[model samples]
Target chain A: MSQKVTRRQFLNYSLMGVGSFMAAGAILPMGRFALDPLFQGEAQGSMITTSVKAEEITEEPVKVDFSYEQQDAWYKSEVTDFVWVYRDGDQIIALSPICKHLGCTVTWAGDDANPNKFFCPCHNGLYEKNGKNIPGTPPRGPLDQYEVGESDGFITIGEMFENELV
Target chain B: MLYNQKDLKVLKDEIEFIDTVIIPFAAMDMDMKAPVHAGNLELLQIVCVQLEKQFKGRLLITPPMMTVGEDTSLLGMYTTQLREYGFKNIIVLTHLQAEPGDMNKIRLNEIPLENMSDDMKMEMINDEVKTVMKSVISIWNQ
Candidate 1:
């Protein structure tokens, strides 16, 4: 047996098929928009990876440079900043290099007299190896700490927090 | 500290702590040396920014002052006004030969930054900044 379709039936069938496709094309975008928040949760991690390895940190603090995209008003630029990192036993600790009194960059043994302390050349501020500000100096508090983690043998930095080791 | 709205607001009551003011002076001659002037201004701005970061608690960086030539008569008037406003030190940072009355001037070295690599440029800029910083510190000590 052979089956044949009339012109009226063919026209009606084609119109329904084309209409369904157009309807789907319009509805899919709206569906995705409604579920957009669910997809954004995965990208909320703010951990920035650094070029240094996790095993490179020693007992003495060393400067570690990290770059990140900074948004300033209408400008977006990559800013490179550094932190003092060291290993305390089995834990990795990272301390902010900004002086507590001012925003000067502190260096490890920057002052010749202060060989084992972080020294700020501006106003002669000093901090111990554990980031505790020395008494009678300009600094009023300990150095701030950065959240650190290791991923694939590389060190990653996250948000800053108050010094917990001090 | 800077000459922005937020810093100025705090500066009103903390003038004693932030007594030093750095005025970045530059020239903008639209002549054959325009590119050289522009490069010098860029380097001056970078050094000013680093100085601000290192001495935010005690130093105030004013806006960059642009001029046409070596005429710095306006700077003298500005310095007098700043002194009246309780600033103990008024240092002019520039890459030009300027003499603004008794105000201190730190002349920066003109480095050819165009033909250098990124690392070399950074090292050169850093060396320049260190020398400028040392001068500022000595002035403070005096």
Candidate 2:
């Protein structure tokens, strides 16, 4: 014989289902947060925006400072980087500001006597217009060069590869 | 470059070009409390690290020379040894003031970093490093 459903049993089943639904609603987000790293892909290098335009650049390099979001493990922060960007004919060249000698930032036309070259004030290091380290300087190599790209009048800089410039 | 095995490995054969040696001199007072002693040592380490980073290729940072009392003849002996090893510039960056001497013995520069904010300390460190760089370049030019 088929048994009739009692109100107490029906209410107990519905309450249990509702309680389980509420418990899952509280725990699912926590579970996802804990396991989110497993689903994340490898950290990819990204292009960063600069306040520079291709047409605005001239033979004399301009110092363009920009920042990017740097993700390190679980910590995230914004880091500032700079480059010396200038136009060489139709090609845009971007040189890293870091000096090859000791990682100090180099400045463009910093010396009054040598106004066309990049100068590192820390150790009197000098670099030529093409990012080549001048002989007799402390720097053992040339400044790094960044892969530059442009679209719709805006310029974006990619990774800086060391001693890339000729 | 620090006085570590990895840095030494690359620089062992290239010591002739690495002419500058930075000897960090900190005074370790026996009467002072442990925390104060630790704090001073830590501050000196930070300052030295920043200085080394600014002139890594040209400067070789030696292990710190600590003094428990007021004696500093050990620094003189150290300077002589570095000179024997062909380092042209042996700079003693001291928290405790070093004795003024002739240019050949050891160059002394006091970095009074006590009771300073981190920003101020960093600014002072950068300034000191720039000065040291200029002097080292002058020596190289000579």
- Top DockQ hit: 1
The DockQ value obtained for model 1 is 0.46
After superposition, which runs of candidate 2 have C-alpha atoms over 4 Å from their true positions?
A1-44, A47-93, A97-107, A110-112, A120-125, A134-141, A148-158, A162-165, B32-43, B100-125, B131-142
The segments of candidate 1 whose C-alpha lies over 4 angstroms from its true place after superposition are: A1-44
Please report, in order, the local distance difference test score of every candidate based on alpha carbons.
0.90, 0.75
lDDT of 2 by residue, B1-142 (tens): 7888988875676576566787877778878554565566666676677666546666788888888764788877878888888777777666564573533222334545777898998797677656655665566566
lDDT of 2 at B117: 92
Q: Given the true complex, what DockQ would model 2 score?
A: 0.16
- lDDT: worst 10-residue window of model 2 chain A: A38-47
User: Chain B TM-score in candidate 2, rounded to 2 decimals?
Assistant: 0.71
Listed in order, the DockQ scores are 0.46, 0.16
